[model samples]
Target: MNQRNSTQLHPPTRHFSVLLSPTPRGARLARLLATEWLRTWELPHHATEAAEHLVAELAANAATHGRLPGRDFRLALLAGSETLRVEVTDTRGDDLPHRRPATPDGESGRGLLLVEALSDRWGVELGPVPRKTVWAELDLSPEFGNVCSGGSGALLQETREGKKPHQAPPLPPTEPAHSRE
Candidate 1:
Protein backbone atom coordinates (compact mmCIF):
# COMPACT_ATOMS: atom_id res chain seq x y z
CA MET A 1 0.00 0.00 0.00
CA ASN A 2 2.92 2.25 0.59
CA GLN A 3 3.87 1.66 -2.99
CA ARG A 4 2.54 3.99 -5.62
CA ASN A 5 -0.93 3.17 -6.86
CA SER A 6 -0.38 5.26 -9.97
CA THR A 7 1.94 7.92 -11.25
CA GLN A 8 2.25 10.52 -8.48
CA LEU A 9 1.76 13.87 -10.12
CA HIS A 10 3.94 16.66 -8.75
CA PRO A 11 2.72 19.89 -10.25
CA PRO A 12 5.28 22.56 -11.15
CA THR A 13 4.21 25.36 -8.79
CA ARG A 14 2.87 23.48 -5.75
CA HIS A 15 1.11 20.31 -4.57
CA PHE A 16 2.62 16.92 -3.75
CA SER A 17 1.49 13.56 -2.46
CA VAL A 18 3.20 10.34 -1.39
CA LEU A 19 2.04 6.80 -0.94
CA LEU A 20 3.00 4.88 2.18
CA SER A 21 2.44 1.42 3.56
CA PRO A 22 -0.65 0.59 5.58
CA THR A 23 1.22 -0.91 8.50
CA PRO A 24 1.45 0.68 11.94
CA ARG A 25 4.96 1.77 11.15
CA GLY A 26 3.68 3.21 7.92
CA ALA A 27 1.07 5.17 9.82
CA ARG A 28 3.70 6.59 12.12
CA LEU A 29 5.91 7.40 9.18
CA ALA A 30 3.01 9.21 7.52
CA ARG A 31 2.70 11.64 10.40
CA LEU A 32 6.45 12.17 10.60
CA LEU A 33 6.81 12.76 6.91
CA ALA A 34 3.80 15.08 6.80
CA THR A 35 5.25 17.25 9.55
CA GLU A 36 8.49 17.59 7.64
CA TRP A 37 6.70 18.26 4.38
CA LEU A 38 4.49 20.91 5.90
CA ARG A 39 7.39 22.68 7.53
CA THR A 40 9.31 22.64 4.29
CA TRP A 41 6.33 24.13 2.46
CA GLU A 42 5.99 26.86 5.07
CA LEU A 43 2.43 25.80 5.78
CA PRO A 44 0.67 27.36 8.67
CA HIS A 45 0.98 25.46 11.95
CA HIS A 46 -2.74 24.64 12.11
CA ALA A 47 -2.84 22.99 8.71
CA THR A 48 0.03 20.71 9.62
CA GLU A 49 -1.56 19.93 12.98
CA ALA A 50 -4.82 18.92 11.35
CA ALA A 51 -2.95 16.84 8.80
CA GLU A 52 -1.06 15.03 11.56
CA HIS A 53 -4.23 14.17 13.45
CA LEU A 54 -5.94 13.04 10.28
CA VAL A 55 -3.03 10.85 9.29
CA ALA A 56 -2.82 9.29 12.76
CA GLU A 57 -6.52 8.55 12.95
CA LEU A 58 -6.91 7.31 9.41
CA ALA A 59 -3.74 5.27 9.53
CA ALA A 60 -4.68 3.78 12.88
CA ASN A 61 -8.04 2.87 11.43
CA ALA A 62 -6.29 1.34 8.45
CA ALA A 63 -3.96 -0.74 10.60
CA THR A 64 -6.61 -1.80 13.09
CA HIS A 65 -9.67 -2.06 10.88
CA GLY A 66 -8.75 -1.98 7.21
CA ARG A 67 -5.62 -4.08 7.30
CA LEU A 68 -5.06 -6.95 4.92
CA PRO A 69 -1.88 -8.89 4.76
CA GLY A 70 0.40 -8.11 1.82
CA ARG A 71 -1.53 -4.97 1.16
CA ASP A 72 -0.54 -1.37 1.89
CA PHE A 73 -2.02 1.96 2.92
CA ARG A 74 -1.13 5.28 1.37
CA LEU A 75 -0.68 8.80 2.72
CA ALA A 76 -1.24 11.62 0.29
CA LEU A 77 -0.72 15.33 1.02
CA LEU A 78 -1.74 18.01 -1.43
CA ALA A 79 -1.35 21.72 -0.82
CA GLY A 80 -2.94 24.52 -2.82
CA SER A 81 -3.02 28.26 -2.40
CA GLU A 82 -6.02 28.38 -0.08
CA THR A 83 -6.23 24.88 1.27
CA LEU A 84 -4.28 21.73 2.01
CA ARG A 85 -5.68 18.27 1.45
CA VAL A 86 -4.70 15.16 3.42
CA GLU A 87 -5.77 11.76 2.27
CA VAL A 88 -5.11 8.30 3.72
CA THR A 89 -6.06 5.50 1.40
CA ASP A 90 -6.26 1.88 2.43
CA THR A 91 -7.15 -1.25 0.50
CA ARG A 92 -10.09 -2.17 2.68
CA GLY A 93 -13.21 -1.92 0.64
CA ASP A 94 -14.99 -4.64 2.55
CA ASP A 95 -15.77 -2.51 5.57
CA LEU A 96 -16.36 1.19 5.44
CA PRO A 97 -16.18 3.26 8.62
CA HIS A 98 -19.36 4.14 10.45
CA ARG A 99 -19.90 6.48 13.32
CA ARG A 100 -21.34 4.44 16.12
CA PRO A 101 -22.91 5.86 19.20
CA ALA A 102 -20.56 5.44 22.11
CA THR A 103 -22.36 4.69 25.33
CA PRO A 104 -21.44 6.12 28.67
CA ASP A 105 -18.21 4.57 29.96
CA GLY A 106 -17.47 3.12 26.52
CA GLU A 107 -13.80 2.70 25.99
CA SER A 108 -13.64 3.33 22.24
CA GLY A 109 -15.09 4.88 19.05
CA ARG A 110 -15.24 8.50 17.81
CA GLY A 111 -12.54 9.01 15.21
CA LEU A 112 -14.68 10.58 12.54
CA LEU A 113 -16.09 13.07 14.99
CA LEU A 114 -12.65 14.47 15.53
CA VAL A 115 -12.13 14.53 11.79
CA GLU A 116 -15.37 16.41 11.32
CA ALA A 117 -14.39 19.00 13.87
CA LEU A 118 -10.87 19.51 12.65
CA SER A 119 -11.15 19.61 8.89
CA ASP A 120 -13.11 22.14 6.86
CA ARG A 121 -14.34 19.28 4.71
CA TRP A 122 -13.82 15.49 4.70
CA GLY A 123 -15.16 12.34 3.10
CA VAL A 124 -14.24 8.85 1.90
CA GLU A 125 -13.59 8.12 -1.75
CA LEU A 126 -14.23 4.67 -3.19
CA GLY A 127 -11.93 4.33 -6.14
CA PRO A 128 -10.82 2.56 -9.30
CA VAL A 129 -9.45 -0.45 -7.41
CA PRO A 130 -11.68 -1.02 -4.40
CA ARG A 131 -9.56 1.23 -2.21
CA LYS A 132 -10.84 3.86 0.20
CA THR A 133 -9.30 7.29 0.43
CA VAL A 134 -10.40 9.26 3.46
CA TRP A 135 -9.54 12.89 2.86
CA ALA A 136 -9.66 16.08 4.86
CA GLU A 137 -9.02 19.65 3.79
CA LEU A 138 -7.57 22.38 5.96
CA ASP A 139 -8.22 25.93 4.86
CA LEU A 140 -5.21 28.21 4.75
CA SER A 141 -6.13 31.62 6.05
CA PRO A 142 -5.40 34.45 3.62
CA GLU A 143 -2.60 35.77 5.76
CA PHE A 144 -0.57 32.68 4.95
CA GLY A 145 -0.05 32.80 1.15
CA ASN A 146 2.67 35.38 0.75
CA VAL A 147 4.55 34.10 3.75
CA CYS A 148 4.37 30.51 2.60
CA SER A 149 5.31 31.27 -1.01
CA GLY A 150 8.23 33.49 -0.14
CA GLY A 151 9.21 31.49 2.88
CA SER A 152 9.39 28.14 1.11
CA GLY A 153 13.12 28.47 0.42
CA ALA A 154 13.92 29.44 3.98
CA LEU A 155 11.71 26.71 5.30
CA LEU A 156 13.40 24.05 3.24
CA GLN A 157 16.75 25.42 4.32
CA GLU A 158 15.66 25.20 7.94
CA THR A 159 14.56 21.64 7.42
CA ARG A 160 17.93 20.86 5.86
CA GLU A 161 19.70 22.53 8.75
CA GLY A 162 18.71 19.67 11.04
CA LYS A 163 15.75 21.37 12.62
CA LYS A 164 13.27 18.72 13.67
CA PRO A 165 9.92 19.49 12.14
CA HIS A 166 7.38 20.62 14.70
CA GLN A 167 4.21 18.63 15.24
CA ALA A 168 0.71 20.13 15.54
CA PRO A 169 -0.09 22.07 18.66
CA PRO A 170 -2.04 20.32 21.39
CA LEU A 171 -5.83 20.62 21.46
CA PRO A 172 -7.47 23.54 23.16
CA PRO A 173 -7.70 23.52 26.95
CA THR A 174 -10.69 21.50 28.11
CA GLU A 175 -12.54 23.73 30.55
CA PRO A 176 -12.62 27.18 32.03
CA ALA A 177 -13.24 27.95 35.68
CA HIS A 178 -16.38 29.82 36.66
CA SER A 179 -15.98 33.39 37.80
CA ARG A 180 -16.45 33.91 41.53
CA GLU A 181 -18.28 37.20 41.74
Candidate 2:
Protein backbone atom coordinates (compact mmCIF):
# COMPACT_ATOMS: atom_id res chain seq x y z
CA MET A 1 0.00 0.00 0.00
CA ASN A 2 1.20 3.55 -0.89
CA GLN A 3 0.20 6.64 1.02
CA ARG A 4 0.52 10.18 -0.22
CA ASN A 5 1.05 13.17 2.02
CA SER A 6 -1.12 16.25 1.54
CA THR A 7 0.19 19.80 1.49
CA GLN A 8 -1.52 23.05 0.64
CA LEU A 9 0.23 25.87 -1.12
CA HIS A 10 -0.95 29.43 -0.59
CA PRO A 11 -0.16 32.44 -2.70
CA PRO A 12 2.54 34.60 -1.17
CA THR A 13 0.77 37.88 -1.83
CA ARG A 14 -2.68 39.29 -1.18
CA HIS A 15 -3.86 42.55 -2.71
CA PHE A 16 -6.76 45.01 -2.56
CA SER A 17 -7.32 48.11 -4.67
CA VAL A 18 -9.89 50.86 -5.05
CA LEU A 19 -10.24 54.18 -6.82
CA LEU A 20 -11.75 57.26 -5.20
CA SER A 21 -12.28 60.89 -6.11
CA PRO A 22 -9.56 63.31 -5.13
CA THR A 23 -11.40 65.01 -2.32
CA PRO A 24 -11.19 65.34 1.44
CA ARG A 25 -14.12 63.01 1.74
CA GLY A 26 -12.30 60.49 -0.44
CA ALA A 27 -9.22 60.64 1.74
CA ARG A 28 -11.30 60.10 4.87
CA LEU A 29 -13.00 57.18 3.20
CA ALA A 30 -9.65 55.69 2.25
CA ARG A 31 -8.55 55.65 5.87
CA LEU A 32 -11.78 54.10 7.02
CA LEU A 33 -11.71 51.45 4.33
CA ALA A 34 -8.12 50.58 5.12
CA THR A 35 -8.92 50.26 8.80
CA GLU A 36 -11.81 47.94 8.05
CA TRP A 37 -9.77 45.80 5.66
CA LEU A 38 -6.92 45.46 8.08
CA ARG A 39 -9.31 44.46 10.80
CA THR A 40 -10.83 41.90 8.47
CA TRP A 41 -7.42 40.44 7.79
CA GLU A 42 -6.87 40.04 11.54
CA LEU A 43 -3.56 41.81 11.64
CA PRO A 44 -1.93 42.87 14.87
CA HIS A 45 -3.64 45.77 16.61
CA HIS A 46 -0.58 48.02 16.52
CA ALA A 47 0.06 47.25 12.86
CA THR A 48 -3.55 47.99 11.96
CA GLU A 49 -3.49 51.37 13.74
CA ALA A 50 -0.20 52.35 12.14
CA ALA A 51 -1.40 51.29 8.71
CA GLU A 52 -4.58 53.33 9.20
CA HIS A 53 -2.47 56.43 9.88
CA LEU A 54 -0.30 55.75 6.85
CA VAL A 55 -3.33 55.37 4.62
CA ALA A 56 -4.82 58.60 5.95
CA GLU A 57 -1.64 60.58 5.35
CA LEU A 58 -0.91 59.26 1.88
CA ALA A 59 -4.51 59.57 0.74
CA ALA A 60 -4.68 63.12 2.04
CA ASN A 61 -1.52 64.05 0.20
CA ALA A 62 -2.92 62.61 -3.02
CA ALA A 63 -6.13 64.54 -2.54
CA THR A 64 -4.45 67.81 -1.56
CA HIS A 65 -1.28 67.94 -3.64
CA GLY A 66 -1.81 65.46 -6.44
CA ARG A 67 -5.40 66.30 -7.25
CA LEU A 68 -6.36 66.92 -10.86
CA PRO A 69 -9.79 68.15 -11.84
CA GLY A 70 -12.09 65.21 -12.66
CA ARG A 71 -9.36 62.73 -11.78
CA ASP A 72 -9.56 59.99 -9.18
CA PHE A 73 -6.83 58.50 -7.04
CA ARG A 74 -6.23 54.84 -6.21
CA LEU A 75 -5.55 53.16 -2.91
CA ALA A 76 -3.96 49.70 -2.81
CA LEU A 77 -2.95 47.40 -0.02
CA LEU A 78 -0.58 44.46 -0.62
CA ALA A 79 0.07 41.99 2.11
CA GLY A 80 2.73 39.31 2.20
CA SER A 81 3.66 36.97 4.96
CA GLU A 82 6.05 39.48 6.44
CA THR A 83 4.99 42.92 5.20
CA LEU A 84 1.95 45.01 4.44
CA ARG A 85 2.31 47.77 1.86
CA VAL A 86 -0.06 50.72 1.43
CA GLU A 87 0.01 52.69 -1.81
CA VAL A 88 -1.87 55.73 -3.12
CA THR A 89 -1.55 56.54 -6.80
CA ASP A 90 -2.60 59.87 -8.30
CA THR A 91 -2.44 61.41 -11.75
CA ARG A 92 -0.06 64.21 -10.91
CA GLY A 93 3.22 62.87 -12.22
CA ASP A 94 5.05 66.18 -11.96
CA ASP A 95 4.26 66.85 -8.33
CA LEU A 96 6.65 64.69 -6.33
CA PRO A 97 6.37 64.43 -2.56
CA HIS A 98 9.17 65.62 -0.29
CA ARG A 99 9.93 65.53 3.40
CA ARG A 100 10.21 68.92 5.04
CA PRO A 101 10.45 70.02 8.61
CA ALA A 102 7.21 71.40 10.02
CA THR A 103 7.32 74.68 11.91
CA PRO A 104 6.08 74.71 15.46
CA ASP A 105 3.34 77.15 14.55
CA GLY A 106 2.27 75.42 11.35
CA GLU A 107 -1.07 73.67 11.39
CA SER A 108 -0.22 71.27 8.58
CA GLY A 109 2.78 69.74 6.68
CA ARG A 110 3.35 66.94 9.15
CA GLY A 111 1.78 64.08 7.22
CA LEU A 112 4.97 62.68 5.70
CA LEU A 113 6.69 63.09 9.05
CA LEU A 114 4.15 60.83 10.66
CA VAL A 115 4.47 58.39 7.75
CA GLU A 116 8.23 58.27 8.12
CA ALA A 117 7.97 57.66 11.85
CA LEU A 118 5.34 54.95 11.57
CA SER A 119 6.40 52.93 8.51
CA ASP A 120 9.32 50.58 8.36
CA ARG A 121 9.98 51.76 4.80
CA TRP A 122 8.35 54.37 2.56
CA GLY A 123 9.04 55.96 -0.83
CA VAL A 124 7.57 57.53 -3.95
CA GLU A 125 7.43 55.89 -7.37
CA LEU A 126 6.92 57.97 -10.51
CA GLY A 127 6.27 56.34 -13.84
CA PRO A 128 3.95 55.00 -16.63
CA VAL A 129 3.20 58.55 -17.75
CA PRO A 130 0.96 61.00 -15.88
CA ARG A 131 0.90 59.05 -12.64
CA LYS A 132 2.80 58.69 -9.39
CA THR A 133 2.49 56.28 -6.49
CA VAL A 134 3.44 56.97 -2.89
CA TRP A 135 3.86 53.82 -0.84
CA ALA A 136 4.62 52.78 2.73
CA GLU A 137 5.38 49.40 4.24
CA LEU A 138 4.87 48.05 7.72
CA ASP A 139 6.87 45.05 8.89
CA LEU A 140 4.61 42.34 10.20
CA SER A 141 5.40 41.11 13.68
CA PRO A 142 6.61 37.53 13.99
CA GLU A 143 4.22 36.94 16.82
CA PHE A 144 1.31 37.42 14.46
CA GLY A 145 2.66 34.92 11.92
CA ASN A 146 0.84 34.97 8.58
CA VAL A 147 -2.11 37.31 8.93
CA CYS A 148 -3.36 36.80 5.39
CA SER A 149 -3.06 33.03 5.17
CA GLY A 150 -6.59 32.78 3.80
CA GLY A 151 -5.94 35.31 1.01
CA SER A 152 -7.27 38.85 0.63
CA GLY A 153 -10.00 38.00 -1.87
CA ALA A 154 -11.77 35.85 0.70
CA LEU A 155 -11.43 38.57 3.31
CA LEU A 156 -12.84 41.12 0.86
CA GLN A 157 -15.77 38.81 0.18
CA GLU A 158 -16.34 38.56 3.89
CA THR A 159 -16.24 42.33 4.18
CA ARG A 160 -18.79 42.61 1.41
CA GLU A 161 -21.11 40.21 3.22
CA GLY A 162 -21.71 42.85 5.90
CA LYS A 163 -19.55 41.32 8.57
CA LYS A 164 -19.30 44.86 9.91
CA PRO A 165 -22.22 47.26 10.05
CA HIS A 166 -20.24 50.33 8.99
CA GLN A 167 -18.30 48.97 6.04
CA ALA A 168 -17.93 51.45 3.19
CA PRO A 169 -19.63 50.75 -0.10
CA PRO A 170 -17.55 49.69 -3.12
CA LEU A 171 -16.23 52.48 -5.34
CA PRO A 172 -17.20 52.78 -8.95
CA PRO A 173 -14.72 52.55 -11.82
CA THR A 174 -13.19 55.83 -12.98
CA GLU A 175 -11.82 57.08 -16.26
CA PRO A 176 -8.40 58.60 -16.80
CA ALA A 177 -8.26 62.11 -15.43
CA HIS A 178 -6.01 63.42 -18.17
CA SER A 179 -4.68 62.41 -21.54
CA ARG A 180 -1.12 61.13 -21.97
CA GLU A 181 1.16 63.69 -23.55
lDDT (Cα, tens digit) per residue for candidate 2, span 1-181 = 9999979876578788999999999999999999888988887776788889889999999999999999999999998876788999999988777655689999778887777667656666777779988887765653233232122211121222333222211222331111001
lDDT per residue, candidate 1, 1-181, as tens digits?
4875698665443565676666778778877988888889887886777778877887778877878888888777888766687888888866667665777788558676666656655666676577877777665663322233111121212232353333332222442211110
Q: lDDT per prediction? A: 0.65, 0.73
- By TM-score, who's the top model here? 2
Model 2 off-target regions past 4 Å? 1-3, 6-8, 143-181
Question: Pairing residues by index, what is the TM-score of model 1?
Answer: 0.66
RMSD versus native structure for model 1: 14.6
